[model samples]
Target: MTLKEIVDKLGATVGLGADKLDREEEYCFASDLMSDVLTLKDTPVLVTGLCNVQTIRTCDMANLEVVIFVRGKRPTEDMVELADENDMILICTPYSMFKTCGILYGAGMKPLY
Candidate 1:
């Protein structure tokens, strides 16, 4: 799914990098554990409930771009700045991780498996 579609479908708040909305994400990975996230390939969209600088750092280390912060958890200013520096896309959704994953999956977004 496209970033714009995910945002619209999930009714997410685009916390950062609206300019990067045109990018397409083929796979989705839901995990609060940064260690698990490190194993992802294809720069899959991260569906997470954890919002912190470490989240941004994990994304950076994994070379991922798009992130969906579930349950309305948003990144801090410093995290946003770091993401901006890394050219990452940030989104916050009010839905739980399961709901968000279901929504995106129903929208034709594939799994990271």
Candidate 2:
């Protein structure tokens, strides 16, 4: 599905603009463990509750295109800058990790299993 669709479906607030949010992401992986995230294959969209700079770094390392920070967590300015520099999209949602995953999954975002 498209990133815009995912944002709308999940009621997420995107931090980036049209240039960044206008992309398609088919796979999604939800986790707080950066090490586990490093094991992923393609650049799947990520749903993470870890509100740290490393979260964004991990996404960069994995070539992830988007990151949804669950539970109302927002990334630091440094993280945002790095994400922008890396051409990554950042989204924030008030939903918990479980609800975030459920909402995206229900919207047809395949799990990165």
Across residues 1-106, which tens digit of lDDT does each residue of candidate 1 receive?
A: 6789889999999999998888888888899999999877668888999899999999999998889999989789999999999989999999999999898889
lDDT, residue 48, model 2: 89
Task: Score each candidate by Cα lDDT.
Answer: 0.90, 0.85
* Model 1 backbone overlap count: 0
Query: Residue 73 of model 1: what lDDT?
Result: 90
For each of the candidates, the C-alpha root-mean-square deviation to the true structure, in angstroms, is 0.9, 1.2
- Model 1: residues with Cα > 4 Å off, grouped in runs: none
Instruction: Give the range of the ten consecutive residues with the poorest summed lDDT in model 1.
Output: 38-47
